[model samples]
Target: MKLYIAEKPSLARAIADALPKPHKKQDGYIEVAGGDIVSWCIGHLLEQAEPDSYHDRYKKWNAADLPIVPETWQLKAKTQTRKQLTILKKLIKQADELVNAGDPDREGQLLVDEVIDHAKPTKVKKQNAKRLLVSDLNVGAVKKSLSNLKPNSEFIPLSVSALARARADWLYGMNLTRAYTLAGQKVGFKGVLSVGRVQTPILGLVVRRDLEILNFVPHAFYEVLAHLNPNLDQDINSQTSETFTAKWQPSGACEPYMDDEGRVLHKGLAQNVVSRINDQVGTVLSVDKKQKKQNSPLPYNLSSLQIDAAKAFGMAAKQVLDTCQNLYERHKLITYPRSDNRYLPKDHHKEASQVLAAIKNNQGQEASKVDGANTRLKSKCWNDKKVEAHHGIIPTVKKLQSASLTKDEKCIYQLISRHYLAQFYPEYIYNETQVEIEIAKGKFKTKAKQEVNLGFKVLMGKSELDSEEKLPALIKGQKLLCFKGELIEKQTQPPAHFTDATLLAAMTGIARFVKDPEIKKVLKETDGLGTEATRAGIIELLFKRGFLKRQGKQILATESGIALIQVLPEQVSKPDLTAVWESSLSSIAQKELSYQHFMQPLLQQLSDIIELSKTCDSSAFKSLPEQKPNKKFRRKRKTYKKAS
Candidate 1:
């Protein structure tokens, strides 16, 4: 008998539907004709045992119990999924061959692989196991995946990488959470101070931004614009007259009067420049014109999609992820929703016609945008080498059931479809013109960008179209008249508070925030702070823990959040550690680093952190409001009387 273990029930059903069937649904699995069976794990059937499970003394949070390192890590069946685990165990023993049919990512690899380990199938059966990677739930996609099953052993590095991440997180989060919570208790704070590998760094980002905003000092800056006309003799109101504005560029001699950013700090300097250029004749020093083409934005990766949804609809990251999951799993309308890669497999280009047809038929008014899409046009997004474990989230060829979708779902679906359709459209083309003018020994310049071809922008709506500015044809050394000069005053503004969109963007592009060049380089090459699947949940966890709150659409760190960051060590609060770990984790996935080599240093680091945490000041936590205890219902322990 062949046994297929899937990540979830929906996937199991999808796999079953693609097989030769006369299917019989059992309590926990489905039996197919030809003695094949398919079963599923409810997310993860097992999880890392709690610290208490390792030892009785570790049950309560204690300072002495710092750095609780497990000598031999153990996995215990999750209480809710114990029954499903039992059914899988029995099936594994009866099966002649096995297949690991999890989502094609690190976590998915570990979740199902751990179950097979827990079931303890015969060594021969285990070694002979195959892997089925399915990113789409559609029957056709699943059938294609079935024919391409590879040896499960080939992905052992991926499983190890996932295991290392899980254990590292456990070691880091569990120890730090306990160590910090105990320290907070010492300072009369009532809340359980939680610190995580990813969550703490996220909190640090917000707290730092908030402090920067609070301490910001606005400064005034001045600019001089030369209003010029190509024909000074022509009437100003005449349609034949061509006029434009150019900004004054300060010379090196004026450095003392300017700020570091090239903004003129002294209003007198700007006024003098305005007076010098007004109603004067200026010579055009340079005239450069070029046509540029911009390709449409690539297809939706989870982070990009989340950022856009947050911007357009003010939806939270979790809300967008949930909607995407529904679209991918239940509706089967799109591909995998947790991909970090924005590039699609080149082979997917073959299905462009069918995907385009589905978009045209399903989208109502938006369907019209698909009419001009040329399926023959291939965008840079179709790169086989750039495609990762999963391709970009795109609409499948399945017909849409628009009436069944919610308002948000419809919005999200349209976004994914639009991006995919945009791949087939022509590049947006424009003419960029730069003119440099010299007047009274001062330089003034202006740039004009006029649309040459709307291309994909036609489908993207008016907001995406560039505002056109026309410049009259001119040659270098050509004379023009400056009608008047205008002095503009501006103030430098503080950085904006993080919203759902900006926060997700920060998390994905965290390299921008790091100071160390080496770590920054590594972070740039890696998926940022958290994976696409966990970033939303991490943000939500902060809110649930009272560490973060929202003001309208802005995400702000609460007092408790700020205090926790203040009390923790710098390494514990910054993204540097995550960057280093991700670098090592990637190496582990590529077989360049061993799990032991990664964990040993981490264990030592945890010890050092716990040791340092003991000495840090807890005063910041003392000022925080006491956290109220959650009222949770506990089940009564039933007692049985012994019979004589």
Candidate 2:
């Protein structure tokens, strides 16, 4: 019998539904069409064995057994899902062929492949495994993918990279967590000081932001504005009369000396400028008009989609991921939702047309506004070279079950579908007009924009509308009356706390934060901080571990988080280390670097980090509030004494 294993049960059900009839449901496996059995992995069926699994002595958390690098790694079935693992093993024993129907990414390849290795016994003949790369859960895509299954061996590098990453994280998290937790105990700190390759750096981002906020001192400054009216003959209150605000330029010594932030440092100087420009008639220095065009935003990558959902609905990052996943698996309305690529394959033009048709039929008036112009097929979004493991998240040809969607699901679907519909619309065209007016000895500037074509904005609604000031028709040499002038006092503000949207952007573009040149360049070529599939979980982990807290929509680092950063070694807290490591993982995936070569240096670094931590001062941890020893431990001691 042919056997298929999927990443999740929802995905397996979608696959079963797409296949021909005879999908009889069983306890864990499904009797699908063509005598096929479909089963699903609940994410990872087996995780790397914990440190205690390596040796019983390792469980006591002794500094002497500092770096616990296993010679040969072990895997254990997750207790909650061991029964499912058993079911898969039993099926593997009976089946003549197996299909690795996991997600189309490095993690997914490893998730199912690793389980196969662990479940199948040594005596059982190894069945030929084929990879089924299905990005969309729709019937056509699923059938096409099954017809062209690639040999599973073709993706061994991806599995190797995934395994290497897992092992590296294990070494770093396990060894370093033990090292620090033991050190903290000596200082009377009772809690575990958890650290990971990605989580720690992300924590540092929050802590660093918190520090900037705590140390920020608001600076007061001033700005001068002059209100000018064109056509002096017309009454100011008349509908035809045009007026605009011009900002005074700081070119002269007497004028306010502008600071780096563009704020005038001296209010008296600004007041003097206002007084000089007030009630003066000035000639327009220049009227510059340039036409510009803005293309519609590309389709949703997981990160971009997460950002939009957060801004529009105040939904958390994880919530957006879950919703998008539901849209893909449960509804079969979109392609795989956990994609990093924002462009579709060049050959997807036919599929694009089908998707557009489905959107127009189901979504109603908003989609009808999309022109589907002649140039739609030739858009830059359809580039074969740019398409990576998966294409951008876009609606499928499947008729969307819109009526059944919840409010949030509807909002997310519209946001995604609109992007695809926008590709056919023309660019948003506008003419930018800038006017400079000379008032007395000072120059004042005002700008405006005129919309030439609504284009994509017509479908995007009011949120994407351009609100730039509209300039009144004027001649370059004409003079205008400065009807009003004022000095506006303002205070320089600190950077805003990170919202879920901004935080996701920061995590994806973390290379921008690094000062080191080498690591920054490495990070630029890599998916920053964490994979799109993992970043939401990483953020959630931070909150669960008390490293990050939420206040309204803003993310703040807790006191313990701050203390952890202070005490942790630079390699642990800084993002540069992870940036370099991620580069190696990428190389491994490309077959440019072997797993051993990558692990060799990583193992050496792990040893070096442990040595560095031993000699380092531990006093930095004392600043945090101390917690009493565990009451359970104290009770255990009293019971032992009574038994003795």
Top of the candidates by TM-score? 1
Clash pairs, model 1 backbone: none
Candidate 1, residues 1-644: lDDT per residue as tens digits?
A: 99999999999999999999799999999999998999999999998887768997776667787889999999998888899999999999999999999998989999999999998988999999999989888888899999999999999999999999999998998788778877877767665677788999999999999989989999999999998888868776788789888889999998998888888899999999898888899999999999999989999999999999999999999999999999889888899899888999888999888888887776722766777888889999999999867899999988875578888888998999989988988989988899999998899888888788888888767734355556888899899999889999999999999999999999999999999998898888888888899999999988988889999999999988888888888898999997678778878988999999999998988999999888889988887886532221011011001100
Off-target runs (Cα >4 Å) in candidate 1 are 463-468, 628-644
Off by over 4 Å in 2: 18-27, 32-34, 93-95, 119-128, 230-240, 252-258, 360-378, 400-402, 463-466, 475-478, 481-484, 615-644
Which digits, one per residue and each the tens of the lDDT, describe model 2 over residues 1-644? 87889999987887787777877999998897788889999999998887667887764667788799898899998889999999999988787788899999999999999988886634333445888888998878888777888888889899999999999998998788767766766666656677788899999888888899999998889888998888766677888778888998777564346777566888788888888887888899899989998888898899999988899899898999999888887887889999988998876777766777777665623644643443344556988888866898889888854477777777888889888777777788988889888989788898887888887787756634356776789879898888889889988888889989989989889899999887787788887888889899889988877778999999999888888887788777888888778888989999999999999988888888888767666676765664222321232332222220
Candidate 1 overall Cα lDDT vs. reference? 0.87
Candidate 1 TM-score over all chains jointly: 0.96
TM-score of each: 0.96, 0.89
Q: Whole-model lDDT, candidate 2?
A: 0.81
Q: On a 0 to 100 scale, what is the lDDT of residue 300 in model 2?
A: 82
